[model samples]
Target: MYQYTPFDRQFVHARAAQFRDQLERNLAGTLGDDEFRALRLQNGWYIQRHAPMLRVAVPYGELNSAQLRAMADIARKHDRGYTHFTTRQNVQYNWIPLPQAADVMDKLAAVDMHGIQTSGNCIRNITSDALAGVAADEAIDPRPYCEIMRQWSTLHPEFAHLPRKFKIAVSGATEDRAATGWHDIGLVLRKNEAGEIGFQVRVGGGMGRTPIIGSVISEFVPWQQILVFIEAVVRVYNRYGRRDNAYKARIKILVKAEGQKFFDAVAVEFKNILERDLDGSAHLITQAEFDRVNACFVRPAGVVAQPEVAAAADLPLAYRRWLERNVHAHQVAGYRAVTLSVKRAGQAPGDVTDAQMDQAADLADVYSCGELRVTHDQNLLLPWVKAADLPALYEAAKAAGYATPNIGLLTDMIACPGGDFCALANARSIPVAAEITERFDDLDEVFDLGDIDLHISGCINSCGHHHSGHIGVLGVDKDGTEWYQLTLAGSDGSNHAPTAVTGKVIGPSFAASEVVDAIEAILDVYRAERTAGEKFIDAVKRLGLEPFKAAANARRTATARHSDTAEA
Candidate 1:
């Protein structure tokens, strides 16, 4: 994890103080709500359906034990006793009071954390693979580059007030775990034939009311010029991206509308930026600066390669299952990356209570070099777990309710704080997520189902990344009644599905009560039709959506008939 430098600390503290003044002015009626909206949004404060929400940025999903503890304290003292982890790898407090928002920001700054650029039409939190440094298949560690981008994007004067929110994701691994193809700017760290580090840049992918996969703008941009190239891209969008209509304001819409014209314009802009000697090389990332950032990402002091240990056949069944599902292979010998599942019955997916957060921090201190990574799938990752400590960690995690042993299983779904907290949400996502989790509680059945990305969103905003799920459920409203639309065969560009594509809707929307049954019906089709050893997503692709669609509609029809009978 990158340690905050003296300047970084000063900047965050100063920003927090500034926010306090702005908030006070708003409260005293000196600043109207309209005038203060942008100010508060830049600092990650939002007036949601029921209360003020604050989203704390976890840049590239990196966090230290102290930061986690600070967030836990805030949860305990300011907001509700829990916080929600978002798909973007940020943290949100749904019930924080507006008056105390400034105080929360101050506390966050004390721990080298804050909510800067977490909302508003700016570059949001930069995300990367949770297993970035330790992944066995990595081409180059992306953490350093992610940090570089983070520093460049944070409070950037030129790009702060874009037409719409922009997102960027970086992936260096052979597999696309970071969903780079779905970001507004997706960067894949790679080396050319000469073995020099650079990036494969994809631009304009996003999800909302419109879902579009990013187009490959440049196959390779030298690592040193990444910042400049990205600047050109954003600059082009800033000049031409629609601002009059919020719905069509995303870079994706601009890219889609312009196509080759957009790509050509960006190319010209990139050339001009260099030709004009803009900033006189100030924006260029020199090797010294790269080295400085890269040094922070090196293996923590106590972490080193260890001798391999043989697997024991006598391991407990539960522990073995947990290892199978939650433990990921590490690049270093005799180490593993373990996921602590926050998705379980009763609670919403990604919701971690204060006690749970504190416990996670303690687990990080004891087992992971006092560092934790928030996963894109709304889970916490211990990235430096020793293979030898698997049993002990499993026991501790189980006791802490973080050992659900369902990493990619159906229950380990991603869901946003829906109508329950988000005013923009058309329906509640929590109940839908909870129902599906309860329906799939049987581990045996879940494992047999195998590696399903079940993502739910309360609306079209895609905060929960529903468009990327193999089984996507989108909450909709029908004449004031809550309904859900199901989609099949969406891919987040993971190893399972290398191409990022939006899921196709199965059929007409289902009533909220029929959603779980609809999901069950879809999976039933998979189980019946899939070939041996095929994953749910692969099965969906092999057999077209017709079978799943028919099965889901059948369930919906049966539910309607039953309701009609009861009414009669």
Candidate 2:
């Protein structure tokens, strides 16, 4: 984890103080609500459906025990007793009062955390693979580069207000765990034949009312010029991206409309930045600055390679299952990355209670070198777990209800806080997610069914990343009733599906009561149609959506007939 420097701490504190002044004036009838709207949004405060929501940035998903504890305290004292971890590697509080917003900011700053640039049509948090540094397949650690971009984008005068919200993700591993293809700007670090480090730049990928996979703009951009190249990309978007309509303001829209023309414009801008501007080369990352940032990402003091040990054949079946699902390989021998399952029965996916946060912090201190990482899949990861401590850690995690062995199973779905908390939600997402989770509570059945990415969103904003799910459920409003639209064959560009693409909608939306049954019917079709060992997504692609669509719609038809019979 990158340690905060003196300047970093000072800047965070100053920003908190500035927000405090603005908040006080707003409450005192001096600054109007309209005037304070942008100010509050810039600082990560939103007047949500019920109360003020604060989105605290967790840059690249890195966190220390101290920061985790601070957040736990805020969840306990200030608002609800839990926090929601988002797919973008950020945390949100849905019940914080507007007046106490400044106080919350102060507490966050005390631990080197804040909501800066977390909201409001600007460059959002710079996210990367949760297993960036430790993944066995990594080509280069991306944390240092992510931190560099974080510093550059925060409060950037040139990009404070773009046509719409923008996001960027980076992945250095051979596998795209960060879902780079779904970001406004996706960066994949690689080394050329000359062993020179550079990035594969993909721009214009996003999910919303319009979901598009990013196009590869540059095959290889030298690492030193990443900032300058990105500047050119955003500069072009800011100049031409749609501002008249909020729905079409994302760079994805511009990229989709212009296609090759958009890429050409960006290339021209990159050349202009490097050659036409007086300080063209000023933004180039110097060796010294890179070294300074890179040094902070080194292995923690006490963590080192240990003698490899074999797993005991006598281990409990449940424990073995947990190990297989939740533990991941690390680059360092004898070390593994362990995921704490926040998605389980009876809870919304990614919702962590205050007590659980504290427990997680304690686990970090004891088992993971006091460090943690938030994964893009809406789970917490102990990135430095010793292989020797697996048993003890598993036991502790089980006791805390975080040891469910369903990491990639259907039960481990991603869902946003829909109508329950979000004002923009067309329907409630929690109930749908809860129903699906309850229907798939049997681990044996889940494991047999194999890995599935089930994502649910309250609306088209795609906050829950429904567009990337193998089985996607999106909430839609039909007249005044809540309904769900199902899609199949979507992917997040992981090993499961090497290409990132939005799921294709099956057919008409189903009533809320029929969603769970519809999902069950669709899975039933998959089971009957799939070949031996075929994953759900592969089956969907091979068999097409027609079979599953027919099954789901049949369930809807049956339900409607049953209702008619009852009315008769």
The parts of candidate 2 lying over 4 Å away from their true place are: 277-281
Return the TM-score for each candidate structure: 0.99, 0.99
| Whole-model Cα lDDT of every candidate shown, in order | 0.92, 0.93
Give each prediction's root-mean-square deviation over alpha carbons: 1.0, 1.1
Residue pairs in candidate 2 whose N, alpha carbon or C atoms collide under 3 angstroms: none
Quote the lDDT for 138 in model 2.
Answer: 98
Off by over 4 Å in 1: none
Worst 10 residues of 2 by lDDT: 273-282
For model 2 the TM-score comes to: 0.99
Question: Over the stretch 374-433, how does candidate 1's per-residue lDDT look in tens digits?
Answer: 999999999999999988898899999999888988898999988888999999999998
Q: What C-alpha lDDT, on a 0 to 100 scale, does residue 420 get in candidate 1? A: 89
Q: How many backbone clashes are present in model 2?
A: 0
